[model samples]
Target chain A: MTTIIVIYGLLAVCLVASLIKSRQKTKKAFLVAGKALLKMGPSLLAIIGIVGLTLGILTPETIEKLVGAEAGFIATVVAAVIGAITLIPSLIAFPLAGSLMRSGATVMTMSVFITTLVMVGVVTAPMEIKALGKKFTLLRNGLGLVAAFAIAGIMGVLL
Target chain B: MIKTLKKFAIIIILSLVFIAMAIWLPDIAKRSSIVAWDYFKEMIIIMPPVFILMGLMEAWVPKDKIQKWLGNRSGIKGMAISFALGTLPTGPLYVAFPMASSLLKSGARVSNMIIFLGSWAALKIPQLIVEIKFLGIEFTSLRFILTIIALVLVGKLMEFLLRRKPDKEYVLPGEGN
Candidate 1:
């Protein structure tokens, strides 16, 4: 844990130094999203709403007890299905998986959950559509869901 | 006042839904809370640094450079590089998106950007260590291989879609008007 902290700290320092050195050369538009994120806040909120709903519906205990040793495989399926309708940050997903593991959840479960959490985002559909346009967002996320499940399944098989 | 009211209305609707779920499917609410908190804690520790890293990337990397490296003109080679770059150690998906949006605006192909963002979230190195520790090396290796394939495939699919009829309204990060 200490080592992790130290490594992260060094990373932070490096990033900051890089930022400082390049501050003058960097475009303000790039750094601040040219203040458009605020306008996009509502879309972001909607995405959050979807994520919360999915998280609320799926429980780690339910996944663990039900899936057991095959938890990883089961998790991939559940995550892919859920991910098809949800959107959440990876930071939140990882720890959620960690917590689940602490309580006897399988790697397959965590792996699937994390991958889906990132890749498959149904909740963000509207916002994604609005931003990147409909076809692009849907195709990307759809592919992502398939990938999440495949990855989980393959991991289960090989690992 | 109207905006505030709208916000409040949204919150109320959400709360009512939660209340309904709690009342009817009480187990769901209870279980979700139990799961959410466990994940939430580690997130608290890791997220700040991740956010900072993202901010730094935003603050440092030039959009043009990103474009030059992985723009639409860069083709398949650009896609491969984007995939590898996206696999770099990083944080959650949300934090990465803003940076990605910036890249897109600077001429980075949407396909490559999407691939990078997707892979960034799915294929983290440090998180992989944690996964290995908990799940064993075999599982970790499998997950990695699967995720990589998925990310690449997804990227290709996204490219195909973009080619069909790309949207002009996508407001890139720096070019948000």
Candidate 2:
């Protein structure tokens, strides 16, 4: 809700400022935006479908069951892998993490899940590759997974 | 047109999968469709303004200015600016991709842009509040500190690796250089 308002508000302000400066440039901005949006159409749709499928299949209960049933390093690996592939909205994900923690999931597993969930985007890789190129996407995500594990290991020790 | 259709092959396959799920797993299908529809609506509402903002940036912000502000020699200042720009916005990571692309074209360093994208994904303000809520202050603070350190390391590594050998540049659709 706030995100929408802030974005639209910023857009409205920027659009007006650009229009006041030069109608031609403002029109060009619109053209660029439209072209980029059109170019991204397929990848965006694919991501939405994939997110739906992943989240639909891995409900919070299902996730709890999966992560809870496992223990030790294997559980952390499972949590991280699931987090990497699924793009669950943080709103649902944090609470799910809380519940998982209560259900005996380790800090390492929960932290790994949350960290990878934010940093990695296997499902959205097509869109990312389209926007940022294949190499950039792969390197960023690959490094992100490594960092997630490191962070999780530290959190496990400290917390 | 054919190229466009080829790009959409994944979507077509996904639709078939959805149809199959609807036949054999109606409950999952129903849930999936509802979740997808919600996300679709969010995307429709959020993406236009984001793209428009990126377009405005592309049109208005000069390349040299971007370079000076976020370029390699910009140093610590550039990283700070990138972090500020990233953390201020509240959106999914996808929304940052186009903006990052535009900035990169304008000569922003890969390291700085990595910081931008990293903070955009992991260090959001609202996201922190939620994390603190469910996960506790100690846990949230620890992750935040660790994430910053990790992001800087990762960003510098990417910069080094990419500079050693540049990757294929991607041209936007309908764009001609």
Candidate 3:
């Protein structure tokens, strides 16, 4: 994919530049990268497992089924809750949301679903807590939940 | 060793859950493993360079530079920079967490950091194209506009709440991250 190519290209260029400018500093950067990667290994594994479970069970077809079956405010709330918790890759999620829209899920529900899906990360909270600290993790995600609802409500009303 | 053991606790728990799922719900378990394997490939592929970039940043970029660019007084400029940096074709949300931690240690403001993390999670340019493709221009554009506005609000709100208390100094993960 383009993402892979661009990142590797950039990395290659940067690595060459860093090595040319200061081999020792470049070595230290690799050291730091290794340390950080090691520190994160366990949590990363945990997150991948959670993502797998989420996707395995809550496939796009299943999401469409669940969101489409409900209607009104309750449906929006349900959608928001699901979105807040699940970390579906946007590649899979948008098409799923689009299809749900075509099938009769309300605009409010779809918008909230997509918004919360991006903003909130209940499943990844442990990794977040590890990286950002408990309070920062709590406040960012908690406030994000509020903002997601507000965006969804306003979008619901407008479009 | 205790700290390392503590770190693995959640992984162990999740692995146990996976095992339980495998026993009771073999189909879902198989599906989950497949999904996990797929993501694992993606993560290893895209994550190294990302961490290298962060490592390079941590080693090369000075704290004053980060602070001046993304610190509180930098205001709208700082916010804009944070959002722009985040919208880069980075791997995923988790990849941003370590960099955000580094930026915080390097003295980036909470508000800008919030915006950075939020946009990284939600609003990558490539992801937006995908969104527009599937969801339509109207839907994509509107969501984009709204997400920006909401992120700005979220940034300000988090800054107000977290910074007001003073003791909430985000401890960098083991010093300057």
User: Which predicted model would earn the best TM-score?
Assistant: 2
Instruction: For model 2, state the Cα shift of residue B110 in Å.
Output: 0.6
The window of 10 residues in a row where model 2 chain A has the poorest summed lDDT is: A63-72
Can you write out model 1's per-residue Cα lDDT over B19-99, one digit (the tens) per residue? 787899887766555545544465556545544454455566676777678875677888788778777664445545555
Candidate 3 backbone overlaps, count: 0
Please provide, for model 3 over A65-145, each residue's C-alpha lDDT reduced to its tens digit, 9 standing for 90 to 100. 788956688888889888988988888888888888888898889888988898899988888877788888888888888
* TM-scores, chain B, all models: 0.64, 0.93, 0.88
For model 1, residues A29-65, the per-residue Cα lDDT tens digits are: 2345435455445555554444565676754444444
- In candidate 2, stretches whose alpha carbon ends up further than 4 angstroms from where it belongs are B170-177
Candidate 2 lDDT by residue in tens digits, A1-159 = 999999999999999999999999999999999999999989999999999999889888888888984668888999999999999888888888987888899999999999999999999899999899998899999999999999999999999
Give TM-scores for every candidate, taking all chains together and pairing residue i with residue i.
0.66, 0.96, 0.93
Q: How close is candidate 3 to the true structure, as a TM-score?
A: 0.93
lDDT by residue for model 3 (B1-177), tens: 998778788788888989999999999999999999998999889888888988888888887888889875788999999999889986678988988988888888887888899899889998999999988898788888888988888778876766655334564321222
lDDT of candidate 2 over B1-177, digit per residue (tens): 998679889999999999999999999999999999999999999999999999999999988898889986888999999999889856899999998998988888888888999899989999899989999999899999999899999999987777666675843221111
Q: What lDDT does candidate 2 reach at residue B61? A: 93
For model 1, the superposed segments whose C-alpha errors exceed 4 Å read A1-34, A46-53, A65-79, A83-114, A123-131, A152-159, B1-12, B19-64, B73-81, B88-90, B171-177
Query: Which candidate leads in lDDT?
Result: 2
How closely does chain A match the true chain A in each prediction, as TM-score?
Answer: 0.58, 0.97, 0.94
lDDT at residue A149 of model 1 (Cα atoms): 62
| Reference contact recovery of candidate 3 | 0.71
Winner of 1 and 2 under TM-score:
2
